[model samples]
Every structure is written in structure tokens, then in C-alpha cells.
Target: MSRVSLQNPIASLEQLAETPSRKDGISEQLEDDLRSFGCELIQSAGILLNLPQVAMATAQVLFQRFFYLASLKDFGIIEIGMGALFLSAKVEESFVRMTYLITVYDHLLRRIQQQSTHTPLDAFSQRAYSLKSMVTTSEMQILKRLGFNVHVQLPYGTMINYLRILGLEEHDTVPKKAWNYLNDALRTHVYTNYTMPTIACGAIWLACRDQQVKLPTTPGGEWWLLFDAQPSEFQNVAAHIQRLYHRKLDRQQLLSHLSDTEATLRNS
Candidate 1:
């Protein structure tokens, strides 16, 4: 795939930042909207493979950032999703081999029970080549649209670093359930629309609470008390993030919409 033009990545991001849409309070709801049009294609791919949550979250950020600047009409959402996943793998330092990704995709198809008569290896090779071509072309457009902002900071990284700094032992660290919820949080435009660092911290804290991690809390503020006695200081940011979670869109509802849209697309 060709790289995006070396002109300016910011210009494209500006365009994405300005697109108008109805506000759905839940992060998952917004994610469903994006997925309905194939925007979350990579995310689905990650889910099927049980790839690390960090990898999935990284892909989501890339998708949002790319869409912020580029139009979705010329390139289908599936292409963008593929490119986002490929790019994210590189960004997060996970670096799944092209062959491995292809294998995973093939495995996913079988797991989902999609009709495929080819051997897993054969199916993977064919699909990988196709996905690679699409991603190559889309990468060029994405880079041009993004003005070359390839450095995407992820919440997972931030959250882990914060936890370490707060002297939380790995055993007492953020629970898996909380981590999963935070992973979902990354799917929303919240990172782009709000203060991400603060929200990430808050999400970890909340996750810890949900799992009963026994972390201390501030008296009445939005910030939570960490083990080291320093507050994470997410008062304002936490409020917004909490509100979004409180108004979370139902997963089943989103799934129904996705199924309907996929059916329509296939019919078309």
C-alpha cells in the first residue's frame, strides 16, 4: 500500500473533528453507529482472535483519528478498519507478523462459522493478500488525510503506567473486568472529545472499585485516592466519563442494528 501524501495529516484530522452527528450518550452506542457502516471491522477482527485489549484499543484510536480527517465515502469502512488494525499493531509495539494476522483472520472466519471450504492456511493466505492490498492503498489515503500523525498514545499504556506510579501491586492492580470495560471506553470518541488521560485514570479507578480492589477514595470529589496518598485528580474528567457510562447503550441493541445493517449491505 502507498503511504498518505506528505502534505499534512492535521488537515484531515480537522475535517474528522468537524463532522456533525447525533450524540448517543453511551460509548458503546457510538461504537455501534461506527460499526453499522463497517467502521469497526478491525475491532471485530480483534475480538474474534482474542487479541490483547491494548491492540484493539489502539486500532480504535487510529480509526477515529483517520476518520476525523478523511471521508468514509471513497474508501469502505472495512478497508479503513484493516489499515487501522495493521497500523495499530505496529504502533503498540505488538507487531503481529503479517502471516499471523492473516491466520488469525482465517481462524476468525471459521470461528464465526462463515462459509469457507478452503483450508485455514489457504484461506488465510488469500484473505491476507487481499487485506494487505486494500490496506496499502488505504494507508496512503489515511496518511494524507491524517497529515502524518502516526504517533497515537493509548489509554492502556497510560493506565498501566499510572498504576505502577501509584504503588499498586500487580495483584492489586486494575481487575480484568475493569480493564475490559475501559477497553470498551476507548471505542467511543471520548478520547478525542474529552481529556483522555484523566478519563483513563478514572476508568481504572472505577474498574478497581467494580472489582472490589479496595482502593481508597477521596471524600466527595471526582478524584480517587491512590495508595501513595496522591489523588489521581480526575474530578471534572471523571464526571463526563461517568455520565457516558451511565448512559451506556445496550450491547444487544447495538448488535441487532449491526446485524440489520450488515444484512442490508450484503443484499445491496
Candidate 2:
């Protein structure tokens, strides 16, 4: 029996399309900051829980939707990030307690402070409060934004289903490697610009290639199945996702960007 449950997938693009962009200029900056924070938080939570790509993706979706309605200035980035993590765990059916979630935040804050040479508690407290308030308010907003669509089908679930359909159990190294690669892909912000179906198809294709899976065709043919399964409106989304993966985003580059951003945030 599969450990994960199959559920309804989130209609994220639909929700995002309906949400009117806030008029405040700062809202854009706040969204960017919150997105960065959400990425870090999701990375941390994935490590702590040993979560799969599907869970991380679900969390990302939840975080994005929450921020879509709630302003960063009102709730604070930290609290909203934590809350998103908390809510994502529930959505993914991997429920972690709020206390443990807070502890994780505390640990993460301390680590950030140690790296930046700043006081953790003082710097993070106000932001944390803001996160809390935003989460409290945005929780409702997220539900409404989603049209109470609580089901969130993850790529991990699809991977597992594929594995089962293939009848290749017994911890195959190739599939496991492919799964990890897909999980890493989920962490990137590129998915926001593409439809989930397209992203999933691309991630799965990349993972299979990384594992040297004997695909029907090199790339295009294998993706045909995904395209057929995807909604017609998002047909072109795969092209965009493919473009993102082809672009360079090495670890060293990401680390440099993170370091520079952290320094700026601390100095500010």
C-alpha cells in the first residue's frame, strides 16, 4: 500500500489569476521578500521532515496563495512563512504540531543570526509577530482564494503511482534518484511562472533522464503523455518550464545570491 494519499489537486493558477494585484508599490517588494523567506523555510522543513517533493510543492502553493491576499507589512514575513509551513504540513497530510513548528523557526532564526552576525531574537521577533497576524488573517483568505479547494495532489504522489504502475518495487536506485531530483526542482521559483502540470511533466522528465531511465524518446516524446494529460489551456506552460530548467541556476550562484541578500537584510 502506498503511504501517501491521493487527493484533489490545487487549482493554483486559477486562484492567482483571480487575485487582483495590490496597488501598493511596496507590495511587490514584500511579495519578493516573502517568496525568498518561504523558499528557505520550505527547504528547512523538507530537511527536518524528510519530506518528498510533493509535500514541498504543496507547501509552496499554500505559501504563495496566503501571501497573494495578505500584505507582508501587516502580518510580517517570518510569521507568514511559519504559518505556511504549518498549514502545508496539514494539507500534505504530514501534520506537525504548532509547537514543533515554532521550535523549528527559532532554530532557523538562530542559524540565520549566527551566519549574519546579528541578534536573532530581537531581529526576528517583530517579523515573527507580523507573520503570525498575517497567517491568522490569510488562512481564511487562502481558503477563499482557493474556493475551499483543500485537495492538493503532489508530484510525489504521481511518482509513486507511476512506480506502482510500472511494478518496479524493492527500492530501485534509479527511481529514488529521480525522485530526489524532482524534489529539488520543486524548490525553485520557476514553477510559479508555469502551470503545475507543465512543471510536473518537466521535473519528471528531468528526473528520469538524471536516472538514465529508458524513456520512449529523448525528451519531447516522453513529455507528450504529460501534455495530453494537462489541461488544454496550459499546453504552452511546458515550454516555459523547459526554458527555466535549461537556464543556469547552479548551487554556487544561488549561495552567492543568498549571502548577498542576507547581508543586505541584516544591514537594513
Would you list the C-alpha lDDT of every candidate in the order shown?
0.55, 0.52
Model 1 C-alpha RMSD vs. true structure (Å) is 7.3
The C-alpha stretches of model 1 lying farther than 4 A from their native spots are 1-32, 35-54, 97-130, 164-174, 208-268
lDDT by residue for model 2 over 1-268, one digit each (tens)? 6343344343366445443334344443334544655566776866676665556667676665555555543444455556556667677787675545555665665575456554444334654444344456655656665566545545655555554543433346746764654555443444445544455455455555566765444254443363444534333433333443455434443344345434433454
TM-score of each predicted structure versus truth: 0.59, 0.58
RMSD of each: 7.3, 7.6
Best by TM-score: 1
Clash total of candidate 1:
9
* Worst 10-residue lDDT window, candidate 1: 20-29
